[model samples]
Target: MVTPAYRMIRIKNASSIMKIIGFLYIFTIASLVGRTIAALEFNQMMGLFTPGLYQTLSFLALFLIMFVGNTGFVILLKEQVDQELLRVASFDDLTGILNRRTFVLLAKQIIAEHVKKQKHLSLVLFDIRYGGDEFAILLPEANEAESDRLVERFRLSAVQAGIPEIPATLSVSRGVVTIVPDQRTTLETLYNLCDRALYDAKGNGRNGAARTRIAL
Candidate 1:
């Protein structure tokens, strides 16, 4: 699945510039050999080979073309490499969701933006006690009912409908934390609250959601 997408995002004939350089070298050597043979066999002087201004300009143009072509090739390779590295670093290989590190980073950024704007921001984390991994959902500009509905949808998707390439054994019973922060709430506080709520959800029956909210 990933292979086709990776193949498409690449430079076409990226090494062609190198081939062109090799061709130029061979052509120069062959031309010199032919010239030497003619001078010896036919007594031709072969004229002065000193390049004129036009010849110098043409040579520079060729060099410029090669330089540009090679630079583009390098750029394409770098882009593909960067994308692959980012994908591997940012995603969970099994679940196809954001990895824990990426989740926190993006959540922090989103919280900061929404906090400044004084907009509605909700965070829902699904603590899958049985599946060995957690699924977190961040909802910006959303209410409690909205957040609950989203989490329930995700739960059904995991438990009933199922994600592609994922086992159906993954549980969606969650510990949820929702906060409408004022001036006092911090990122650490939000994370701790969510974790506690997850514990509460697990403690209850290990297959339900618990919510704790900080008032706006």
Candidate 2:
């Protein structure tokens, strides 16, 4: 039970609480072994070991078990609950993609980094639903030609996936916008330009993409 509990408390990124828990786990196991040896009358086999030491080990192990069972379980449970809440807040329920709110937040950070690095960034918007649904993709260091190729590949892949309900070829309209990000660039500006390109694709008819490049 203690071994499994120790494994449960261990996480990929170790924290202070994890370190404490690990220490407690090692101490508890050692104390348990000591207590077992004392119980089995193995004390005579070992020289210069006091009976009081076994009593102390037994008491300390019991105390540690109680402490870990109460506080450690609660901490792990709370961590799991917080992670689930974050996942719910950050992702779309149906599509399992980053929702608009998370997208905007991360997009700002990406824009700042790209501006600092003086790199190209591309944003693609398309509808994924049977009739219509919106999804956005951010491509770092992608230029106009690469973005266009990606859009065409995605369009072809969707058609090849072959949804049974659609009698005809699946049509995916995409808006592709590429820019060398600067201090003046913002997610809102990029979104607006991508939206305009999406309108252009829709205007041109289905199964096509519209490309736009921002100078600044």
Candidate 3:
């Protein structure tokens, strides 16, 4: 979740760079204008060199400073923009839950480690369609007995999680797929199995849960 504090910190970081860039701009302008006027008078009196040549060189140096500062400022701004965009893409705006893409990505990372430890992994999905809802529960380490219990509980309690966009409370069907990770196990496969289970629950009735375990 993007907490206020985190957002504020990002804002502060971006603001500080903008301030630096602004100061550099003002300083660069002031230094060049003041120096050029003085250098012109000095050259006129001395009659020994091209008018404003020294000021031009100094202006280039100052402009370089401003240019570098602006570059840094742009980089900082881009970093913040990227972070915000990633956050938005990864989380569902209405439910504040991990979006499907993010969930699959993180779940895969978990599976990679769990497989090394020979641990069981669970995947639960909630489907809210047909104005009804259901749950799908997957327990990779769970036998039929354990999955049955969890599925029953989900059937009884699973509700359609609401978002601000919708006013009416909808129902959901839950689908679960459990698997022991191996060479053939993939995120897409898991999602597909779970999604199928979700449909099964919907076929039986909305507001129900289904469980499926992949064979090793």
Compute each candidate's TM-score over C-alphas.
Answer: 0.61, 0.75, 0.48
RMSD of each: 10.1, 4.0, 10.2
Task: Sort every candidate by TM-score, greatest first.
Answer: 2, 1, 3
| Tens digits of per-residue lDDT for model 3, 1-216 | 124224434555546555555555555556556665775775533233445654565566576666866696677779779889998999879777777778767777777777787766767778756644433334556645666677666545534456679786656567877667776677778778888887787789776677675667
RMSD of 3: 10.2
Q: Give the per-residue lDDT digits (tens) of candidate 1, residues 17-78.
A: 44544444444444556666766896766555544443344455456546755775686578
Worst 10 residues of 3 by lDDT: 1-10
What lDDT is obtained when candidate 3 is compared to the true structure? 0.65
Candidate 2: where are CA atoms >4 Å away?
1-6, 9-23, 30-62, 145-149, 165-168
In model 2, the clashing pairs are none
Candidate 1 yields a Cα-based lDDT of 0.67
Best by TM-score: 2
> What lDDT is reached at residue 194 by model 3?
82
Error of 3 at 125 (Å): 2.5
